[model samples]
Target: MGERLVADLIVERLQAWGVQRIFGYSGDGINTVLGALRRSGTPRFVQARHEENAAFMAVGHAKYTGEVGVVLSTQGPGAVHLLNGLYDAKLDSVPVVAIIGQQSRTVLGSAYMQEVDLLNLTRDVASSFRQQVNSPEQLPLVLDRAFKAALADRAPAVVIIPHDIQQAPAPELEQEHGVLTTAPVWSPPTLVPAPADLERAAALINDGGKVALLVGQGARGARGQVRELAEKIGAGITTSLMGKPYVDESHPLAAGVMGHLGTSASGFVLGECDTLVIIGSNDPWTEFYPPPGAARAVQIDIDAAAIGNRYPVEAAVTGDAAATLEALLPLLEPRPESAWRTSVEEAVQRWHRLAAERAATPARPVNPELAVRELSDRLPSNAQVAVDVGSIVYWYARQLRLPEGVPAHLSSTLASMGCSIPYGLAAKLADPARPVVALTGDGAMQMAGLSELITVSRLWPRWTDPRFVVLVLHNNELAEVTWEQREMEGDPRFDQSQALPDFSFARYAELLGLQGILVDDPAKIGAAWNAALDADRPVLIEVLADPDVPLLPPFPAGEEKGGTMMDALRKEGRDTQHARDLLETYLRQEEGLNRGL
Candidate 1:
């Protein structure tokens, strides 16, 4: 059979898979594919200034649209630029297909211009990587396989199209292959609980006078099942930072998140619980601190490695959260209605009341916490929220409550800064009809590709019209968690030097043809938020915050010293002191709040 050009064949396959937009950067090597796109005129191309931003935008699109987001780049540096974004997509489980235009097949190892080993570089970030195509005939099969791998693994996949092959042409497109249009089948790894594991876990639940249930990102599709398990087990439920969307906060058993910025109730319940059942949560850094001398522990997870990775588990059930919970339901003998459930519920309510009381204070500058609460309350039920990394993330994680069934996206694994703006744009692109809000810190937003706002404006004119809102927490500094490290070391330099100049972020937004509002007063935050959301175009609400405010203390395990600054601080004898002071202040405030003073 005669064959179509590789570029044409790829575009045809993408169209068949329902791809509507290709977010990418143009280059000489990929011009062949671009020409093919121009001629075939199927999937529309949305050009980005940088390949990394293009990949990020595609990730946003995929998350919101539930379609395979496509990003194109030239080989070598261009392909390398996409690595971070690709890794983000992979870790976050966003389905994306990246196509790189490689040097001609003739120069495979000749060090031709823009030639680099893309396949090797992309292997770790991509679920599957295909080398450059040498023949037009192989195009259809390769494209088909790429899509399947991307969707099946729930990750990003890369396909390399050689420049020479993309230019070669022979025949018209063939009939659509059945495999090309079908969704990949996903079967959760089958794991049945051991008879002993179930019995032991059930016994722990029955005997414990107080229990707590903690959920994580792995519980995405199993929220209802988790809630049912919590109710049946008579346990107070809390979530890891990444698991906030799993259960509605309105649930009586919900005790907010349990971590660094976790509520006072979380600490109380976590400390007091006789048993802790960790469900699909692998976060040991902050979320899984076992209480001192607790009754026992049960862990359920799909990944066997995570079963006992953190705390010592008396019972480890290696199975999917929802499926395992369903199975365990029948095995659990009903317990008598006891005071344990009521006690936890009362504690949670008390904490909620205290939080409400604290928020009622009308401070001069708007309290950041109150702003977060107001935004959480005002946004539409289905509004999509994309949060940047910083102290602001802590606030959102602890306070913001999304309506049930609404999806929220964040960079949980990498926890990279500057992800909010791109994520928001991507969310808007993914579902143009759904209102999208970006909660970003000023420092982080400055580091992001501001030019992408132009792309977003061009793509969705309404975003520039005033209805879109980007809430900037203008703390005027990096506000890194490491300040405590500096303080503990008795270094006076830690506090103010880290701050940034008070530039006009709102003005910058205005220059980009979006409405801009500067919020300095606590009482005016709600009005500003409402006005921004009411606008017909995109709006930037730059909120000025005190940079000196400390982040909440780390959990019992202490702050994670992962990066360079943290390592440096550790060497200077500054680490432990900073952690101690931060923890002390946090505990004091928490105690005061709990006392109803």
Candidate 2:
């Protein structure tokens, strides 16, 4: 071990820290490090088709394993490509580390080929920690701090190693900073709200007859406690997009999803609540929460930084989600079930009936919602779903019937496309025993993830079971953005630029040594889904849906009962009668509602 190379030391340290895989493409600047990684041969490197996909894969790995996932790329363009995926981790507060290979210091400051300031390029997204190792002696301290900051801040970090420095002999390693690696299951120091803050929160819950629990991604570990708090207070539970799979939607108090992707039932509960309990989440979107001063609010979170940042806070109890709930549980009185809870329950039940009708009654171009619902029905109880942002989320956010405790991942904070596939791939890599599904639109698949299908081709033969399923809702348009352009701008011309060239995803899959299936007929969707789940390989099911089918959120954009198909069409300048005709046909087929047209 005497006089080891700096690159070799880094690989050894990462291995000691329990890193099993690295995702990236190797180039001249990074060759030395790759060689060192190969020499150690313990942590395997996953070669992705694109640097962006490599970044997304790292994020996926971090989220599923609850550890800092590592990604690497050579300098300049390779570094730039990591930005989008790195931003996802930063925005979502997921721990990830990106290592970039730099040109030799001998070429410093000449604007050399593929040589840009690594720290400067990555600073915005990797603000937690960004460092360049100038000397071989600087390697240990910089690497350790990068890992430390990534975990402690729950954000992405970056480290740059010049080509010349990486091959230099490592100095006597300094172990004085205690264990260099972060905890596998990192837990911040336990924080309890002051006695006065607790009393204030307790008073609000007791005084407000109708309480509503709004869960966020931050409130992940406290699902049971959140449920108890809701039930005890006779409140309904609603979740932000990231919190959608945290609580069982089947719970009587469940208001289903809230915020931009909110269900009508959840929206009603949020609007009607007298007091709101914000748990583990900053609740980033203003649209998701009640208007400021609309209701008294009690906020509980692990990071004090988020308290009162998004919404006005009457009681800010800073602590772990579950722990804070436990502390407050004794201080509050359980309110008996009120009309509020009954109303929420009634609304949810109505929604279920409506949803079932819609799923059964179908129309031409197929109801995307129905397709998703049917797919949801066939997926195993423990299936891990990675949902992309956009039209696909319209189905996944409202329709995908996720069982409680089933882990789900998404790029909610960044709200980016092309994340779902790599997210699923990362999840599958972490836990090969479970089935992982990536739900995306045709635009998203073509954007970033399509190339990574080749990555799957390279890795899938060794996989023991269903490595993953990429469910593409093939409408051949950026449906989510297209809807926004129409509704927000009142612009009906959703020109060619908004549309995608139709693709044969099944045929594309075949060329990659993977299973491919096309499901245009609704009758065969279930069978195709079953075959994919049963297959030992990764499968892509391209579901041909309609471009005209309006993809709407569960609730209205604002405070209205009009996320309905009619409303979407009306805004797009379709005549009232025509809108009604489309709606009636859809309702009749999906919901069996033929009462009027």
Candidate 3:
């Protein structure tokens, strides 16, 4: 076999590994890699505006497709930029591989133009694997190891290759045409819990009067089983933020989210249950954790380490959610309706009614909840939502009840800002036929999403299949965090950083040759979104809302008295309105339900 450039080998191996796209920015350090990509003509290189966005794109791709997301970048700043998104994948347990470029071997010790110690910069975040290829002969083995580690650990892996090494001659191997074998067949093994754990869990479920189910992303493929178990036991279902989209919102037992941005009805379900069946989720929020001593908890998870970490457990089943539930279901019997279960159901119903009332209320400066509700109701059948973190997450999570097929990709685990725009782009890349919508708060949009807007502009002309929409929840403040600082720290005044200066992100969208609409009126918000969905090019809709509106979680996250919230507002010279306003409508609806209204 003829000698081949190591660069060509790398790209060819990537193609053999089923990588269809490589998200990255080319630089002097990585020139050889990009050159090889062009020669191979198998894996397409998508040039991202920023290295960070490229990493996030890979993260989003891996998340939506359940495949290893691949990203590439030059050394130094480029490699450093990938950290944020890599950490995102790390914390979220998504599989991703990062290929970083390095200087020539000659400049290994010198402070060359682009030299920065890559290993030291990335070691903490890319915990699964981190290795640099030193020789041409080592390329295949190194690349293969990184790829396999990503799949096995469901975490990020980094590989750094020097330009000289990439350009070196590669040795022929034993395979046909002396083409060295790159990736071997790799797959994660399916796990099943032991019989004793299943039997113990089933026994607990059978003896308890009230049962509640808590689910997370690990329960994604087990939606049917989760729903079935809940229905059989007459149990209420509560989801961690990541699991919000797994179950259909219209399911009879669905009680919505738990923890920070969760729903009160879901909290009530957990508090009232005697047997709590927690599956998949390891959310650290104590408010959502199974209350100690009140219930016998049975947890099912693929990761054995998470079984009893969040709450005390009587039965901890270590297996896939679907397989574990299948083993336990036969041992359990149907549960009759009880007062606690009935109370939770009624609470859920009332909660929905109250949410609707709040969503319908017309705002003097526009209402975020109303905007989100309109979005939820009017989204096209195949629309995909990607919501950024901060106050807007509450609005999107609570008001937007996605239909059966629609998926909402979120930055929930990392809880990072500026993720929605890039996430929407990656979501579109995964499924080019669906309408992609990105929801962002004022602060989040300005943080990093604005640059992604430019990336959108650049990519708009290249494809026309799936459309894109960016919805900005414009409030000129971090509404949720503002409320939190006051309530948690008893702070007298909010940091000036909380209030974001007003910016017309829509106008910026127009400057980039895309459709942009700024709507301050409540009536225009829905119309703007509808128009954006039908537009040929990407569109940005900036809907202004009142900054004074309180962003409340499912329940109060504080242990102190009520004085903290009101007092802080007064000190800040902001609206000193009643905190009751946040829940007044809900309480009213609950009372009406009690009276059989």
Candidate 4:
């Protein structure tokens, strides 16, 4: 008999890659591999409630670890469930490996139970796809190629292991002893801006009365160069949400973010600048649409697909953001003394002051924005933040101040919900010593894989301390705020029928053996947050908030639903019958509480 079964060979390959853990849910088809893993005892198993959650957890792991996070699922629905997370990983440039099980080799085309064409289903999402491993002889090469494709492309890879093959006897193959390396090679591409292109960009900057730099996610690795360029040209900086951390917000040149949720400073700067130079950013909905229209735009990006995709550009320099910025810096002459820079700086200052006032106001029910700021204040200077999508995203992005060297993770392009928990887990797994927190909305958390909380409890017990805090801003309604916003726009019949039944997230956390705190009073928030962090365990703080409040600093003036709020207030006069009725409900509740006290 051959020394290795097909399953053992697969485990041997995985162990060589230095993979410490594989997040997965086992099924009959993949049980052979599980047994092999048990025997190897090198790469441990972290079981998840659902395969989707497994894939999501892997995404989180890769974000912090920068290693190839591994996920396993059975055939059919299991593999199907893994698709969303895989797509997320692909979009976010997180490296992951998904080991999926298929039906017996004999019944591959015969429609066996839990049998489906996973290869085709996952082709679009995964960076690399492979299947049909009949003998142990092919395992080493197939595995090697899959890892290369995944790490090199910085995307997800899927490997399908057929059931019959898993149990098959080994072939006469040489035992490879070396480790399987899967680290990405970040060599600078050969596409530098031409000398003429650099001169043109420099001339545009030097000649313009006022210039604004629009940075995006592609500027992530080029933060230093971005700051240097901004300083050299005395340029104002505004960023898309994905590019939030490109320039430190505290920097003198930082003008805040742009879009519907944009700050007043970014809008003001965009309106005043004669030239808008975009670097590594391509957010269509936010960056391009509400244009000042007259400003000349120049874009520099490594990906040719991004140029001319969102906003029209007079000059599109195809090169890396940092390198291009360096190339252009020397071509430009220093700006003569100009009031444009001073004027933009004043606008930014005014915006900052206004934001500070809003943050300082101690609302009775603790403003969500204030809550996020308080969280930022309490977190360690180097903590990693993973945020889920919703109204709260705007709140945190606007308020949370990331310290230098701290990396923040968010799914900006896809804007997927239910990502915070998994992302937080991945961050923690990648660096167990660093503090990792997931700021999530109440509705978003329900959609996330709650069972992964148990996985965190089991594997990284140290995180049980306040180190892992999942903050749930409990507004007690789904889609209600948007419906209310629409109702304000002259649609009295705007319905909030999508609101979910309120569930006790505090109880849910306790059930998972993690600390759970329900926060209703504004005064208790600080103490509760402090206690949670000090305890050093996994904690979930469910904040009860009034659902009627609008997500503030209203939408831009001419946006589609911009006038809806004002229209609703006008039609139903401030003291109209409906308003009186709602006020009566509030009065009754207030009186009831007073009497009880």
Best by lDDT: 3
Score each candidate by Cα lDDT: 0.73, 0.79, 0.81, 0.72
What's the lDDT for residue 250 in model 3? 75
The better-scoring model by lDDT among 2 and 4 is 2
Model 3 poorest ten-residue lDDT run = 553-562
In model 4, the worst 10-residue window by lDDT is: 553-562
TM-score of each: 0.85, 0.92, 0.94, 0.85
lDDT of 2 by residue, 1-597 (tens): 446788998897788668999989888889889989887886889888888889999999998888889998988899989999999999989999899999999997999999888878887998889999888777776777888889889999999999999899866745565424223233457776788888999998898867888888877888888888888878888888888877878888887777665576777778778799988776566766777777899998888889888888899898888888888999989765788778778767766765666566555556677778877678788778888877888778778888777888889889888998888888888877888888888998899878888877887766667558888889887877766655555455355678788789989999888999998888888888888889888999989976555544444353232233445466554344543464545444423321211
Rank all candidate structures by their TM-score, best first, as comma-separated numbers: 3, 2, 4, 1
Task: Give me candidate 4's TM-score against the actual structure.
Answer: 0.85
- Candidate 3 stretches with Cα past 4 Å from truth are 1-3, 174-182, 464-466, 556-562, 574-597
Which ranking of candidates, highest lDDT first?
Answer: 3, 2, 1, 4
**128-168: candidate 4 lDDT, tens digit per residue:** 55555555566666677677777767788888878888888
Q: Which pairs of residues collide in candidate 2?
A: 357-590, 357-591, 358-590, 361-589, 361-590, 362-589
| Residue pair clashes in candidate 3 | none
Tens digits of per-residue lDDT, candidate 3, 254-279, equal: 88888767776786787678888888
lDDT at 53, model 1: 79
- The collision pairs in model 4 are 60-426, 61-426, 464-536, 464-537, 464-538, 465-536, 465-537, 466-536, 466-537, 489-564
Tell me how far the alpha carbon of residue 327 in candidate 4 is from the true structure, in angstroms, after superposition. Answer: 3.1
